[model samples]
Target: MLKTLTKTLLCVSLLATFPAMAAPDGDMAPSDKQLAELYWQGQESLKKSDWSGALERFRRLETSLRRTEPASADAAIYWQAYALLQAKRSTEAKATLEKLKRDYPDSRWSKEAESLMRQTQGRPNVASESSGNDDDLAEIAITGLMQAPPERALPILRKVLQGSHSIEVKKRALFVLSQLDEDAALAELGNVATTSNDAELRAEAIRMLGISGEDTAIERLRTIYAASKSSEEKRGIIQAWMIADKPDLVMQAARSETDEVLRKAAIQALGAMDASKELRQLFDSEKSLENRKSILQALGVAGDTRSLVGIAASNESEDIRIEAIEALGIADDDDSGENLVRIYQAASSPKIREAALQGMLISDDSDSMLKLYKQASSKEEKQALLRMLTLTGSDATLDLIEAELDKAGKQP
Candidate 1:
């Protein structure tokens, strides 16, 4: 009896395979390579970010193969389902997956097909396939930090940071905490800074505290700045100290700072502060060219044009010169346009040369920039000037640029 039953099952399974083949006598089924080719074309479309194109390709591939070999359509079907899922056509992907399981349960694509069906339009309301990593999903949740009102996710992240979680979880939570400035997150980070023995956690807290700028965090940084012997920790302190609004501390950080990078950051921060005699003094006197560049960039954050002439005349490192050129735009002084032109006269380095040209566009009109464009020697410099001019698109400017190109024996 057992042998008879087994024979009957084999006969049925074999019979099931014959009908589809006999119906399509005149039509040649696509070869395996053809099917693979179609599958990849769809994948490429998806890769190019054209989800709809990928879906269309998959559908054609599926239909062409299904007539003679329904099972051969598994990859096409899976890709179709994936493209649909990516296109936010969650309902369609789920339905396609269901059909896949029903028609070809034993196929190689069955596992992913069944799993996707469960994920998208499942009872749990999770509409789509998931990344397998727990940390990824948690990080996706943690993106609530970028949501319009950040107060929502603050408490949950605080718990994750303080609680015993995996390092990945803590890392992602810290990232979200960095985004959030809620009283709760700030309070939790402050408490952690004071109490936690974990150096990494304390560092993370200090980083966030800089953004929050609470008095407690400031005091904590002050203590760390004074007592910590580690160079790395002091760098972190200077990094934090730069973000504060206290102008005096910024000058203190810049004038008497120890580390090169920390001093640069301090000078940058002081430049950002209200330009008192102290900030001006540091900008003029700081010996390092890099530190001076930092000071110039900070001056940008303060939005003052007073330092433009001094920065333009420095004749120091090209980097500092380039930074000063960019700072003219931040200063928003169209009145200083002529100064920028004269500065670029002596500016020979490629970066500073281009920056000075771009700065003129913001502070000078196209007509004024046309004269400078004539003075530009190489194609690269001319290209940069033309690009900036194109952004402004003034007719008078175009006319002047044409005249200059004619003079240079070049075409506009």
Candidate 2:
């Protein structure tokens, strides 16, 4: 069905010709061959997802047709409207399509315009005009029901989900069902997530439940994760739990999950949920370097600047300190700025100093970095600070660097 729609969009460039009409510039208009080339160029742009390019080409064609072949202008006009729609300029597309209909009522392109309008509005295409097909009728009825008052639309959509409708229809019904705030609606979504034969639909249902983020939805996800044996399925449940901010279940999975990958996924989810205190505790007890690095990454994601600073300051291993420094950079909290400068000043190894410079850049500690730059006794340290300022991309620091450059230029 989606492919059919894509083909329709791709074929919009092909058009019928009419007798010559007036040219706005009072000059010879582009021949049909020339216009056809432009049309195909627009189609090529559409194929490449270049909406702006397609819009420009179609608009040029519309202008050329308005002058040289007024009757054939509707095709270009319809395609222009279509390009606007594709560009996400819907208000303009609607107006353009309306103009196409108003200006060319009898033209075949007007029917195409109508179909495009229907598509934009999510209505069934009357242009297809296939009657007596029960499936088609049901789809149309369901579409209408979708737009009806929730009081009226809810029951029918639920029935549609339960019925043996097409997967596409079921997906649509599921979406509508998910929007309802009622317990029954959430239950159906959970049912789909847990039992749907279609993997994609099941994932989508899980995602929708996560999006719901209600207590019941979170509980259902927790239950599904506990009962599911498939790692892929459990991973999906963890992601949903992350979205729902069910940190306790995520923390439990992180600690107790037998699967290494699933455990890591749960840890990442914990980071995303900002469970920094738990991750800090886990880091202190964790023995493996790999696991400790993962904890550092989660701390970065959690952006717990105080904890990251503590890790940087106190971690005994050089590698762990470097990792903490890198994590602090990823965390990007300005609160870590002072600590980063401290790390840079006290570090003996060049690599640790380099890591501290990176952390300072990421944390946007321009003032502290510049102050250190001015106080530096070594040329190497001053040069490093200059590089750090440039790398940080802070406008204020850039201005200072520019002024320093200007002053240096005058000295020689």
Instruction: Point to the candidate with the largest TM-score.
Output: 2
Which residue pairs in model 2 clash with each other? none
Candidate 1 per-residue C-alpha lDDT over 1-412 given as tens digits, one digit per residue, 9 for 90 to 100:
1113244233222221111011111222234333544665675576555779989998988986887567577767777777777676788888888878777787677666666666576534352355336667776776655564666677677778767766556656664565564556666766665567766666656665665556766776787677766555665565565544556765776788676656765665565455546666887777776566667756765666667566666765666767677667556555557766776677666666677766666444565567777787988767777877865668876776677678889545
TM-score of 2: 0.58
For model 2, the local distance difference test gives 0.71
Candidate-wise lDDT, in order: 0.63, 0.71
TM accuracy, model 1: 0.45
**What are the models' TM-scores?**
0.45, 0.58
